[model samples]
Target: MTGDQGTGALAVLELLAQEAPAARIEALLHEARRAGAADAELAELARAVELARTVQASAYRGRDREAALAALVDTAHDLTSPYDLDSLLRVIARRARRLLTFDMAYVSLRRTDGTSYVRTSEGDTTALNAGRELGEGPSLGSLAEERRAPVWSADYLDDDSVPHRPGIDAVVRAEGLRAIIAVPLRSGDTTLGALYGADRKVRHFTPDEIGVLLSLADLAALAIQQAALLERTREEVTELERFGSVTNTTLTRVRHLWDCHTRLARMVLDGARLSTLARAAADALDGVLQVRDPGGRPLTAADELPDLDEEAVTRAALQAHTGRSPVPLPGDVWVAPVTAGAEDLGVLVLRASAALTDEDVRLLELAAQSVAALLLIQRGTAAAEGPVRDELLQDLLDRPHHADLHVRERTRRLGIDLDVPHVVVVARPEGGELGKAVAWSSSYAYRCGGLKAVRRGCIVLLLPGSDASAVARKVSAELSPLLGHPVSTGAAGPARGAAGVAGVYEEAGRCLDALTALDGAGGTASLRELGFLGLLLSTDHDVDAFIASTIGPVLEYDETRMTDLTRTLDAYYESGGSPTHAAEALHVHPNTVSRRLERIAELLGEAWQKPAQALEIQMALRLRKARAALRAHRTP
Candidate 1:
């Protein structure tokens, strides 16, 4: 190669620079030939041009590196801001559009099944991609996810390498999309989705642009994961708060129940009566409380309770005791069993003005336990005192001579007087429930001031009263139901002192016998109400002696000889001593009546016809008639 030839090549190169493309290359060749350069010199001119082109390419690479580095730094700093998934995605898309200078930019996430769902978009054509789904078959986004790398298309509409989806095609046409660059959003080895930058006119994407998008995709994936963790932590905190609220409410209820139980237990320990405890329970529960014995008699004053249906309460209480459950009664009432171990002491009835909750029922059951204990104690005390009371009563009624001073002193201590008008009631319980009768009598004695005892197959009560018959009737009515059967009570009194009591008791026993003989079950009879029958019913009356002394000879003549002498005498006195009228009343002849009267005078020692003797004879005859009438009436 000669210096002249090199000079000529240099000149052609400069000409090439001045002109352009194929025509300019031809002009350069003409200049080169005119310079008479050798073939070797022409080759040297080509090599120098190639070297200049290489230098220009290096400068362009340097500029691209600077831009890529700046984009990476901006993305790194942007990620440090506290942004939620939605905000982070929008920022990433906007930054991508700015860095790559594309017509549109967007971010999409891959669903669980690996389908890309576009989340955010930026720029003029963003509307087309908003909320769009990119399928896995072969779009640029799908390719990026499938290959786990960046994908690009210089002209997407003409690119047949990717599968054509109608929706994607429509949007691409509407937005005039010509080129696109997609990079997968990845965390570790997993691909989250894709980040897209698109151009409306044909454009080739460079490696630097793909790299910058890949960095932004990484940041978006991290933001999505952080948001998920934060959401889960918030849900856990809410659940814990709910559990705490429930626990606090339960603790409050338990504490209230404990306080109620403690108060009830303290009442029991203080030796409070069952009625007192029931009142306390009512106050605590804000309801009515009734403590009943096993027989359904209220241990507490029934007046203090509401007007409850006792029958309904009884049935409900039975069901509750049998089933071991709280039975609901009408009018917001509840019935529960009061028990001590296996023994049922009674029933506890609660009638609330308001609706009761389950906790209220529990508190009532606790109170019931305390009441049961009190009732048991009362029964124990009653059992211990019954026998001594029975002994004192028997001695006073049976032998007043031996018991006069002792009885007087006992009555004094008991706050009653034997000298007062008292009735002796002798009750023969026809039901044969002796145990129940005894218990009832004992309880009656304790409640009202009286002495009651079961003796000689009968219950005896000595009560202060004005009328014996009235007292007897009262005792019968009261004890009958308790014993679950009828009682025949006989009373004799307004009797004073122990001797009077003994005599009245004898009369009362005789009355009891007469009542039974008449089959008058559950009937109450006294010496005063027995009428003429009282003469026969009582041993103290002397009607038979009087009749014998007054009309003895008449009785003898009538009994020994079948005669109308006694009948004739009664007829004569009833007719005012008229023989004719007597005969007429006797249904006989007047002369026969005269003869019968004369026979009557002979038998009576000659004063029988006088006014005084006649009055005595008439009285005796009247007594005989009454006795006959009584006998006839009682025969059946």
Candidate 2:
């Protein structure tokens, strides 16, 4: 028995020297009991059991320390890894599971309203560990948040210290989670959320376990903050890029507008037309352009867009004319009014693919203003030239048939060809309408390339045409309405030169008088149309020619035969064709008058006694007696 005891003690010492673990120590102790050792052997077996427990405790502690260190190193590497927020959270949960040697682990972030939702999870098969909210009632995560410290619940479903929720209990039971430990994701005094480790089998949480999870929680908090800041920075960078784009666009448009303005201004200075102005505006704006006149006629080519709205353009133009800014139309069209002083010259319509900015509208307005200025200059020049043209016209038509070199030169300068067939129109307005007539005549004269003057209380125009009647009709029609009175016009034309023009004027004047006598007010006539009256009023009439056409034989017989037969014929007509009354006037005997009458009758033809022939004979004899009296008067 003593030897057996000694051997057992020795074997126990050998086992200790061999560094045998607890299992071998227990097996040897069981064998010693079976062999029924002495008290010393049994005592020695008991000592070995005590020593095995100590060695086992030490080895377990060493392993736990090593695992904790390895877990910390892995967590540090994970935190440094290039992972996004989600990936980082997953890594933290996974690392927490490894660190705590738990079955499951997860991360939860507290919402702004003090509720927590799971952020990431690992080793979870139920909603309990992933995607589940730590409900409003007490939970491991909430406990951690409220205390701003680490918390744990062994048999969480039955822990009285934790405020239990039925739903959370149900999920935990379904996920086979019997214990859970959580540490607040805290920085300083504020808790951001919670990090959790869970186990399927009931387990007690240690201070070291809580400390490891707390470190992970702190790292998670830092990662969450960094992610938030990075996200914000990205947003700021995007906003800056947008602002820079807008600024660049504005600057480019401004430069484009400057170039357009410079080119348009230069064009105006160079006397470009409205069409050119429209084209320049279109080119500058990258659009189609149309310029319209006051009459609504397009001064530029039409746009190719088939759906351009004419009515809308008109309305927009009207609005702009009232000093309102240009209005937008459908299809990205814009209309700006073109005005010169108070006059609305026209509108400018532009069509582009995109809506214009306020700067673009301003550019269009500038173009419109430039166009208005061009129109104003043109009108001013025309207004200034009006009087000058009127003066030149007056010189061309002035009368008295003066052969002055100045008149001829002026006529040439004025573009009047008196040598050509030209007509003169005399318009007489009744009822005190001379001013109106003059105004009308002035415009009419300018349009017709004619000259107007007030002569003999009538508007006289020297026009460049041969048809006097046509001119007279036109003057009467045009001036009558303006004067608000009846206008009578007499035109005489196809006149030879400036010198012969005076004679035509005289004829035209007599025609006027004849029209009035004949109650032909508002009548137009020429010399040929007036018949015998035209000859009487002619300035170029010859008295000798009148006598020859009437009684040429009687006058020739008196001169050739030295007879008084021509005298008898005149006296006979004065006596109503009776020779006896004519003889008494002549102080000659009736027989002598009768013989002369007989001779005169023989010289004159039978048809000369007719009423028409008699009238001609009477006029010729009267003209001859007037000539003889005029001669006697001149000789005295």
Winning model by lDDT: 1
The C-alpha local distance difference test score for the whole of candidate 1 amounts to 0.73
User: lDDT of each prediction vs. the true structure?
Assistant: 0.73, 0.70
The numbered model that scores best in TM-score is 1
How badly does each model clash, as a count of residue pairs? Answer: 0, 0
Ten-residue region with minimum lDDT total, candidate 2? 377-386
Model 1, span 1-636: residue lDDT tens: 788667755665675556434455445556665888677876776665565456456546645655655565556456545467788788888888888788898888878876778888888544667888776577778888878778888998999886678888888898888998888776545777888889989997765566556655655565565455445544654676677753666556656876776676556545566567878889888888877766776667323665778889889878878886678877888888976434566788788878888778878777776675455433433333444456667777777676477667756755568788888899988866587688667756654567777778998988888788888887777677666788998888778877777787888998888888878878998765565466667766768756776778778988899898988888888888799999989899999999988898888879887766676677778988999999989956
User: lDDT tens digits, residues 345-449, model 2?
Assistant: 678888876788877887888788667655543342222233444554454455655655755665665456667887877778877757757755665565466
Off by over 4 Å in 1: 1-281, 291-307, 339-346, 401-405, 408-424, 431-436, 447-449, 463-485, 492-504, 526-636
TM-score of 1: 0.39
Q: Which stretches of candidate 2 lie over 4 Å from their true place?
A: 1-19, 127-129, 135-137, 241-636
Where does candidate 2 clash, by residue pair?
none
